[model samples]
Target: MKRVYNFNAGPAALPKQVLHRAQEELLDFQDTGMSVMELSHRSKEYEKVHQKAATLLQELLQIPNDYEILFMQGGASLQFSAIPLNFLPSDKTANYSLSGSWSEKALKEAQKIGSTHTSSTAKETGYSTIPSQLTLSTDAAYLHITSNNTIFGTQWWEFPSTPSYIPLIADMSSDILSRTINVEDFSLIYAGAQKNLGPSGVTVVIIKKELLEQCPSNIPTMLNYQTHAKNKSLYNTPPTFSIYMLSLVLDWVAEQGGIEAMERINKEKAELLYETIDQSEGFYIGHAEKDARSHMNVTFNLPSEELTSNFLIQAKEEGFVGLGGHRMVGGCRASIYNAVPLESCQALADFMKSFQAKNR
Candidate 1:
C-alpha cells in the first residue's frame, strides 16, 4: 500500500502504525468479540483502552500531578465558551492576547460571557506575528493565549508572561504534543486531537486541580470542566475509537522516544520546508516572519497565482495531499504534523526545488 504526503491541518494524517493496529483490532479488541467502536464506554474492555490513552498522555507530557487530564468532546471550540462559563467570574476580567483567528474567536466568545480585556494584539500584521509581551491585569480571572496560530502559520517560541497569581490558559490545538513544554507553566491547556493527537472526535484538556476546583457552578453539566473531571471524562460516552487510536499513536511516540525526540524531528522537518522557501530566491514568499514560523504548519506562496495553481496540481499528481492553505488566506500550507515522516518532508523539499527549477 502507498501513502501520500499528508499535510492537512485538521482531520489530518495519522500514524500508519496506529491505523494498522486499529485495523488489526477492529474486529475483536483484546480478545473481546466486539470492535472498540461498538463497545459501551462503560464496558471493562473499553475502559482499559480509555484509561491507557490518558495514562500514555500523562506519561508523555510528564504532566504535573496537580493537573487533571480530560478527554472531552465538542472540540477545542467548545472550550472557547466552556472556559469562560466555568472560570471567568462575573466580577473579574478575562485577559486575552489577540494572536490569530482561533484566539479571536475565543476572545469573542469570552466577551459574551463576562468582561474581557485585550491585553495585546497582532491584528495589524494579519495575525502573522505573536505579541512579544502582554499587559495582563492582576484582577483578571484568566489570561488566554493560542500557543500556535494554525491559519497564519505562526507560533509562540515562548509565551508572554502574565500576572503571577492569574491562571494562564492556552488553546494549543495545533501544536499540543509537537514539543516539550513545562506543563506547570500553564494553569490549563486544551487541544483538538485531529492535528497532533489522534482524530477529530476527541479533545484533550489538561487543567490544574486548583483551576478545576475553582470552576464555577450553575454551568450546564456537559459544559462544566468540573463535571468531566469528577466523572473522569466519562460524564457521557467519550470517543472510544478515537481514544483507542490515540493510545496507539502515543505508543508510537514513545517508541520513537519522548516529546524531546518528537520536537527534534519536528524541527528538522520544518527547517527543510522553510529552507526550501527561503532558498527559492523570490520564487516563493513565506507568510510568517522567521522567528514566528510554526514547526507544524508552513505557509507560503509561489511567484504568481498561476504558478501556485500549477504547483498544487503538480504536487497532487506527485502524491501530495492537503497542500493548500486555509480559506481565510489563499496560499500554500504544508502541515508537517508528527504523523508525517521526515522522508516525506525531504521528498516535498525535493519536489519544491524541482518545481522551482523547471518553472523559473
Candidate 2:
C-alpha cells in the first residue's frame, strides 16, 4: 500500500510507531487477556494508564505543581461553556480576544451564560494577523485568548502581558504540545487531543489549583472543575479508549525528545512549506502575516479558485490528504501537526513547486 501523508486538521495523523504499538497490544495489554477498551476504567490497570498520561504531560510541558491535568469528554467547544459556567458568574464579565473562528465561538458561548467583553478583535484584519495589544479589564474574571488560530492560520507569537491579578485562559486545541511553553503563564489551558496529542473525544484541561477553588459550586456537578479534579478525571466512564490512545501518543512524544525536540522539527517543517509558498511568486499566496503564521496549520490560496481545486485533486493522486481548507475560509490548509514528518512537508513543497511551475 502507498504511504499517504495525512494532514487532516483533527483526527489527524499519529506517529506510526504508536499505531504499531497499539496493534500489538490490541488483544491483550501487558499480558492481560483483554483489549484496553475492554478493561474497566475503574480497574487498577486503567488507573496506571491515566496517571502516566497526566504525569508525562506535566513533565513534558513542565506544568507547574499547582496545575491539575484533567482529561474530560466534550472537546474544546464544551470548554467554551464550561469555562464561563464554572468561573464566571451571571454578574461578572470575562475578557476575550477574538483571533479566529474557534475563539469567536468561545466568546459567543461565554455571552450565552454571562457577559463577555472583547479585548481585541482581528475581524477587521480578516484574521490574518494577531492583535498587537489588548486592553483587558482589570476586574474581569479571566482573559481568554486562542493561542493558535487553525482555520485562519495565525498564531500568537507571544502572549499578551496581562495584569497578574487577572488570570489568562488560552484555547490551545490546535497547537498544544507542538512547542515548548511556559505553562505557568496561563491559569487554564485546554486542548482537544486530536491535533497534536492523539485523537478526538477527549479534551485536556490544565488548570492551576487555585482556579479550581474559584469554580462556583452552584453549577452542575459534571461541569465543575473541582469535581473532575477531585475525581482524577474518572468522574464517569471517561473516554477510556481515547485516553489510552493519548497515553501512547504522549509516550511517543517523550521518546521523540519531548516538546523541545518537537519544536525544532515543527519549525523546520513549517519554514520549509512557508518558504515554498513565499517563493512561488504569484502562484501561491499565504493567508496570514509572516510573523503570525501558525507552525501547525498553514493556510494559503492559489492564483484562482479553479487552480486551487485542480491542485487538491492532483495532491490526492500524489498521496497528499486533507489539504483542503475550512469551509469558512475558501483556500488550502496544510496542517503539519507534531506527527506529520518533515519528509511529508518536503513532499508537499515539492508538489507545490511542480504544480506552480506548470500553471504559473
Candidate 3:
C-alpha cells in the first residue's frame, strides 16, 4: 500500500507506529479475546487504558497536582458552550478575542450562554494577524483566547500578560501538545485529541482545581467538568478506542523526547516552509504576517486562484494531500502538526520551489 504523507487539519496524521500497534491489538486487546472497541468501558482492562493515558499526558505536559485532566466526548466545539455554561454565571460576562473562524464560533456560543464581551478582535484585518492590544474586563469570568488560529494561520507567539486575578482560558484545539507550555498559566485548557494527541471523538480538558470548583450544579451533569473529574471520565461510556489510541500516541511522543523535542522539530519545519514562501518573490504570497505565522498551520496564496487550484491538484498527485484552504479563507493551508514528519515538510518545500520555477 502506498501511504501518502497526510496533511489534513484534524483526524490528521498519526504516528505510523501507533497505527501498527493498534492493528496488532485490534482483534484481542491484552488476551481479553475482544477488541478494545468491544470491551466494557467499566472493565478492569479498559480502566488500565484510561489511567495510563491520563498518566502519560500528565508526564508529557508536566501538569501540576492542582490540575485535573478529564477526557470526555464531544470535540472542542462542545467546550465552546461548556466553558460559558460552567464558568460564566448569569450576572457576569466573559471576554473573547476574535482571531479566526474557530474563535468566532466560540464567541457565538458564549453569547448563547450569557453575556460576552469582545475584548479584542482582528476581524477588521481579515484575520491575517493576532490583535496587538487586548482590552480586557476587570471582573469578567475569564479571558478567552484561541492559542492558535488553525484556519487563518496565525498564532499567539506569547500570551498576553493579563492580570493575575483574571483567569485565562484557551481553546488549544489545533496546537495543544505540539510545544511545551506552562500548564499553570491558564485557568483552563481544552483540545480535541485528533490533532496532536490521537484520533477524533475525545476532548481533553485540563482545568485548575479552583476553576472546577466554580462549576455550578445547574448545568447538565455531562457538561460539568467537576462531574467528569469526580467520575474519572467514566461518567458515561467513554470513548474507549480513542483513549487507547491516545495512550499509544503519547507513548510515541515520549519516545521522541517529549514536547521540548517536538518544539525543535516544529520550528525547523515551519522555518523551511515559510522561507520557501518568502523567497518566492511574488510567486507565492503568505497570508499571515511573518511575526504572527503559526508553526502548526501555514496559509498562503499563489498569483491567482486558477494557479492555486492547479497547485493543490498537482500536490495530491505527488503524494501531498489536504493542501486546500478552508472555505472561509480562499487559499492554501498546510497543517504541520507534531505527527507530520520533517522530511514531509522538506518534500513540500521542494515541490513548491519546482512548481514556482515552472509556473513563474
Candidate 4:
C-alpha cells in the first residue's frame, strides 16, 4: 500500500525501516513465540527491549550517567504539573519564558500548583518569534522553556544563559531528537514519543539525578521523578508496546548515522520548504521570523484565507495530510519531523509553487 506524505504533528511519521522491523518482530520477538505487545513488562524479553531502548537513547543524546531516563505515561502535559509539584513550593516561585502555547500552558499549570513567574513572554507578538531581552531569576525554583513551539513555528536557537544554580527544564515534546542537543545543559528534559520517537503512549523524561533529591515527599508518588527513577521506570506497568516500538525507531536512527545525520537532513528539508515560501514574493508568507523559525514544524500562509483553504484541499489531493495549521491559528502548517523524508518536503514544495503559479 502506498503511504501519504504524513505531516500530522504528534503520532507523526516514523521511519519506514522501523515499521518493517516491527512488522517482522510482531509475531515473534527474538523467537519468543509472542508479540512484544503480548509480552509481560516483567518478562526477560520485554526487559531487554526496555533496557536496550534506554541504552540507545543515552548513546543518541549523549546523556551522562548522572541523568535518569524515565519512560512514563501522561505525555508531556502531565509534567507541567509534575514539575511544579516536585520543585515549586507554594511560598517560592518558578520562572518561565512564555514563548508559545505549550510554555504558556506549562506556566499556568505551575501557577495552580504554586507561584510562578514569566521571565519573558512573546504573547504580545502573536507568538511569531522567541522572546528576547529576558530577565531571569536565579532564585526561582526552576526555569521552564519549551524548546520548540509547534503551533507558532518558532524555536529557541540557543538557550538563554542562566546561572548554574538555576535548574533549566525544557519541554522538548515536538523537537526532542530531531537535532543534536547538549543534554548536559538541562536539569530535566521531557518529550512525548509520538513526534521524533515512536507512538503516543509513552513520554520520556531525562532528569539529572541531583534534581530528584529536590522533590518533596508530599507529592503524588507517580508524579515524583524519584519514584520512577528508583524503580527503573517499572514502578507500575509500563507502556510496553510503545517502549518496544521506540527501541526499533532508535535502532533506525543509529543505522541512519545517528542524530547528526538526522540534523543535517532535517535542516535541509526545512530550508527547502521555507525557501519555497520565501521565494513566492507576496504570494506566500511565513509565520515566524527567520531567526526563530523551527525546523520541525514550518508555518506559512497564502495571500488570502480563501487561498489558504484552497491550498489545503490541493495538498490533500496530492497525498499531503495534516497541512492545516491548527484550530487556534487558522492558516497552513507543515510538521516535518525526523521521519519526514526530504523527498516528501521536495514534493510539497513543488506543490506549493505549482499552486502559487496557477493562483497568483
Candidate 5:
C-alpha cells in the first residue's frame, strides 16, 4: 500500500507498526473468537486491554501514583465544559491563559459556567506567541493553559507557575506523550487521543486523587470526574477499539524508549523543518517566535498567497499531504507528531528546499 507523508493536525498519522498489529488481530483478538470491537466492555478480555493501555501510559509518562487515569468520550473539548462544571466552585474563579484558538474556546466554555478570568493572552501578537508572564490570582480555583497551540504553532516550553493553593491544569491534547513532563507540576491533565495517543474516540484524563475527590457531587453523573475515576473509566461503555489501538501505540512508544526518546526525536524533526524555514531567507516566514515554536506543529507562510498555493500544489504532487494550515489562520503547517518518522521530516525538508529553489 502506498502511504503519503501524513501531517494532519488531529486524527493524525499513527505508527505503522501499531496499525499493522491491529490488522493482525482485527479478526480474532487474543485467541478469542470475536474481534476486540465485538468483545463486551465488561469482559475479561477487553478489561485487560483497557487496563494495559492505562498502565502503559502511566509507565511511559511516569505519572505519580496519586493521579487517576480516566479514559472518557467527547474528546478534550468535552473536558473544557466538564472541568469547570466539576471543579470551578461558585465562590472561586477559573483563570485561563488565552493562547490560541483552542484556549479561547475553553475559556469561552468556562465563562458560561461561573466566575472566570483571562490571566494572560497572546492576542496582541495574533496568537503567535505564548504568554511569558501570566497574571495569576491566588483566589482562583484553577489555572488552565493549553500546553501546545496547534493552530498557531506555539507551545509552552516552560510552563507557568501559579499560586500553591490554586490547582494548575492543562489541555495537552497535541503534545501529550510526545515529551517528558513533570507530572507533579500539574494538578490535572487531559488529552484527546486523536493527536499523539491513538484515535479520535477516546479522551484520557489524569487527575490528582485529591483534585478528583474535590469535584462537587451535584454535577451531572456523566460530566463528573469522580464518577469516571470511581468506576475506573467504565461507568458506561468506553471506546473499546480506540482504547485497544491506544494500547498498541503505547507499546510502540515503549519499544522506542518512552517519552524522553520520543521528545528527542520530536525535537530533531521540528528543528529540521524550522531550520528549513529559517534558511529560506524570507522565502518562508514562521508564525511563532523561536522560543515558543512547537515541536509538533510548525506553521509558516510563503512570501505571497500565490506562492503558498503553488507550494502546496507541488508538495502534494510529490506525495506530501496535510501541509495546509488551520482555517482560522491561513498558512502552512507541518505537524510532526510522535508517530511521524524522521525520514518523513527529512523528505519534507528536502522537498521544501527543492520547491524554494524552483519557485524563488
Candidate 6:
C-alpha cells in the first residue's frame, strides 16, 4: 500500500500502527463479535477503552490526580462557549490573550457570555507573532490562551505566569500530546481529538476538579464540567470509535517512548523544514517570527502568487497533500503533526528545494 505525504492542519494523519490495530479489531473487538463502533458506551469493553485512553494520557502528561479527564464533544470551538458559560460570572471579568484565529474565536465566545479583557494581542502583527508581554488580571474569572495557533504558525514558548487564585485556561487543540507539558500549571486544558489525539467527534478536556466546583448551578446539564466529570465522561453516549482509536494512538505513543520521544522527533521534523525555508535566500518568506515558529504547522510564502500556485500544484502532483495555506492567511502551510514521520518532512524539504531551484 502507498501513502501520500499528508500535511493537513486538522483531521490530519494518524499513526499507521494505530490504523492497522483499528483495522484488525474493526469486525471483532476482543471476541465481542461486533465492531467497536457498534459497542455500547456503558459496556465493560468500551469502558476499558475509555479508561485506557484517559490513563495513558494522564501517565504521558504526568497529570496531577486533582485533574479530571473528560472526553467532551464539539471540538475546541464549542469549548469557547462552554468555558465562559461554566466559569465566567457576571461580576468577574474573563481575560484572554489573542494569539491567532483560534484565540480570537475563543475571545469572541467569552465576550458573548460576560465582560472580557484582552490581555495582549498579535492582531497588530497579522497574527504572525506571539505576544511577548501578557497583561494578566488578578481578579479575573480565568485567563484564556491558545497554546498553539495552527493558522498563524505560532506557538507559545513560554506561558504567562498567573497566580493560583486565578484560573488559567488553554485551548490546546493543535499541539497537545506533541510535547511534554506541565499539566498542573494550568487549571484547564482542552484539545479536539483530530490533531494529535485521534479523529474528530471527540474533544479531550482535562480540568482541575476544584474548577468544577465553580461551575454555576444554572447552566445546561451537558455544558457543566461537573456533569461529565461525575459520570467520568460517559454522561451521554460518548464517541466510542474515536476513543478506541485514541487508546490505540496512545499505545503507539507509549511504544515510541512517550512525550520525550515525540518532542525530539517533532523538533527534528520542524527543523528540517524550517532549515529549508531559512536557507532559501528570500525564495521563501516564513509567516511567523523565528521565536514563535510552530513545530506542527510551518507557514510560508513564495516570492509571488504565481510561484505559490505552481508550488502547490507540483506538490500535489508529487504526492504531497495539504500544502496550501488557510484562506484567511494566503500562503502555504505544511502541518507536520506528531504522527508525521521524519522521512515525510525530509521528502518535503527536498521537494521544496527542488521546487525553488526550478522556479528561481
Better of 4 and 5 by lDDT: 5
Looking at candidate 4, the ten consecutive residues that score lowest on lDDT are 132-141
Kindly indicate the candidate among 1 and 2 with the higher lDDT: 2
Q: Rate residue 189 of model 1 by lDDT.
A: 96
lDDT of 4 by residue, 75-96 (tens): 9999998999998876678999
lDDT of each: 0.91, 0.92, 0.92, 0.92, 0.94, 0.93
**Pairs of residues at least 3 apart in sequence or in different chains that clash in candidate 5:** none
TM-scores, all candidates, are 0.98, 0.99, 0.98, 0.99, 0.99, 0.99
Whole-model alpha-carbon lDDT for candidate 3? 0.92
Best by lDDT: 5
Give residue 338's lDDT in candidate 4 (0 to 100): 92
lDDT of 2 by residue, 112-168 (tens): 888888999999999999976688765688899999998999999899867777889
Residue-wise C-alpha lDDT for candidate 5, range 57-150, written one tens digit per residue = 9999989899999999999999999999998988989999988999999999999999998999999999889986788766799999999999
TM-score between candidate 1 and the true structure:
0.98
**Candidate 6 or 1, higher TM-score:** 6
By summed lDDT, which 10 consecutive residues of candidate 5 come out lowest?
130-139
Per-residue accuracy of model 3 over 1-360 as CA lDDT, tens digit each: 888977888889998999999999999899999999999999999999999999999999999999999998889999999999998988888999998999999999999989889999989988889987888876688899999999999999888766776789999999988888999999899999888989999999999998888899989999999899999999889999999999999999999999999999999999999999999998889999988999999999999989999999999999998889988787899999999999999999999999999999
Give the CA lDDT, 0 to 100, for residue 315 in model 1: 97
Clashes of each: 0, 0, 0, 0, 0, 0
Candidate 3 wrongly placed segments (more than 4 Å): none
Clashes of 3: 0
Error of 1 at 329 (Å): 0.4
lDDT of 1: 0.91
RMSD of each: 1.0, 0.9, 0.9, 0.9, 0.7, 0.7
